[model samples]
Target: MNADEVLAIYNDLAAENVPVWIDGGWCVDALLGKQTREHADLDIAVAREHAERLRELFARWGYQPQPRQDATDWNYVVATGSGSTVDVHVFEFDDEGNNTYGIEYPKDSLTGTGVIAGRKVRCIAAEWMFRFKTAYTPQDKDLEDVRALGERYGFKVPATHRRPAPRL
Candidate 1:
């Protein structure tokens, strides 16, 4: 999704009192304070308590749920008629701060605040993004994202992700 669409959704959800945290590649761009590439879809993390509200919002916007091989009740995707999609990750935390359900998102990982299109937005923290980017075998975009984060914030990137230059 493009920034305007993403922001519109964010604003709409906010108006309904459903908080959403931007995640994945769009999040990287949020942290970078600009859009680095075209985003195919938006990734968002919301509290489990808000999933129903989120679903209703999506339904109202003509976003149909897309079946997925790995979708759990707490995580799934919805796509609009225009091909804009959103990957929704629902999460919960215990009183002691442990992840109790859905994605294993630590509370601190959500502390990041960044700007998108000149508006402040909540996103996954850079350190957590760095760890997530390096946690698995990365695609070229992931490598580029990690390298960009490393270059911008002085995070330690794995040796393999230190690309010599961008691929043509």
Candidate 2:
């Protein structure tokens, strides 16, 4: 999806008071304060209790539940019948008021907040994104994302997970 479409979706959900945070490639761009690349799908984190509402929202957009292997306690993708997809991650908060559910992101891993198309947006911290990107064998797209983050934010991802860039 393009930035405008991404922003529109987020804005619509925000208007409904859905608590969501941008993640994945689009999230990297959001963290860097710009759109660094094209995204095939949107990634968002929502509270588990809000899943049903999220489903209803997507249903209104012509998206339907797709078969998903439970990767964790709360992660899955829903797709439009035509193939567009949105990856959803469910999270819970700890007593310290830190996000500690689903994937284990350190409390301090939350970096900053910004506005995307006038809507307040939360993004995965740059350091944490770099850490996550490096934790996997870098696909070309991942390498590109790492390079973009480095270029835009001066955050260098280590070469630990370096791999040949994926052929576009």
Candidate 3:
């Protein structure tokens, strides 16, 4: 999705007072204050309490669970039956800031704020974003995000995450 679309989703959630944190590649670009690459979908983190509400909210846009082998009550992709998608990652934490359900997001990791299409957005912190990107056997897209974020944040990307050779 483009930056404007990203902001639209974020703003709609905000208007409903549904707290959401932009995650994945968009989060990296948000933190960097510019688009580093195109995105096929949006990844978001929301409290488990808001998951149902999000489903209801996005339904107006023709979004529904697209289904996947990895789909869970807390994680799944919603789409309009075509084009881009919204990948939702739901999580909850107890009073002491330990994960209790759904995705494992440390409380501190949710404290970041960045701009999308010139509008501020809540997103995963850069340090945690970097940690997450490396905490996987990355695809080429992940490598590009990691490289840009690492350069901007002074983190050293591991050798496994290579810069992709240019496509002709």
Candidate 4:
């Protein structure tokens, strides 16, 4: 997803008062306040209470549910006929900031603020974003993302992910 499409969805959702926090690759770019690469989908974290309303809005915008192998009731993707997609991650946070449902995003992980296309946006915190990207067996894109975050946030990129993605 490009910045314009991502922003359009974010603004529309804001218009409806359904809050969301950007995650994944877009979150990296958001935290950096600029686009670094092309994205296949926009990932967002929403309160479980608003998940249904989020879906309703997408339906009105012509987006349909797109099934994936990892699909779950709280985590799934929706796509438009034009192929733009949003990967929705729903979470229920407890009074103490623990995640009680859906993705295990830490209490402070969603506290980040970023700029996309000059408009400030909520996103995963920089430190948490770095940790999440490196926690997995990274793809080429993940490594690049981690590297960028490292450079920007002063974190050391782990040796395991220091190797560059192989060139075909």
Candidate lDDT scores, in order, read 0.92, 0.75, 0.91, 0.94
Q: Which portions of model 3 show Cα errors greater than 4 Å?
A: 164-168
Q: Write the per-residue lDDT of candidate 3 for residues 28-83, one digit (tens) a residue.
A: 99999998888999999999989889989999878888869999988999987667
Per-residue error (Å), model 3, residue 61? 2.6
Model 3's C-alpha root-mean-square deviation from the true structure amounts to 2.4
Query: Which residue pairs clash in candidate 2?
Result: 140-166
Question: Candidate 1 — what's its lDDT?
Answer: 0.92
lDDT by residue (tens digit), candidate 1, 8-103: 999999999999999999999999999998889999999999999999999999999998999888889999888999999999998998999999
Of candidates 2 and 1, the better by TM-score: 1
Candidate 1 Cα outliers beyond 4 Å, as residue runs: 164-168
Model 2 residue 125 distance off true place after TM-score fit, in angstroms: 1.7
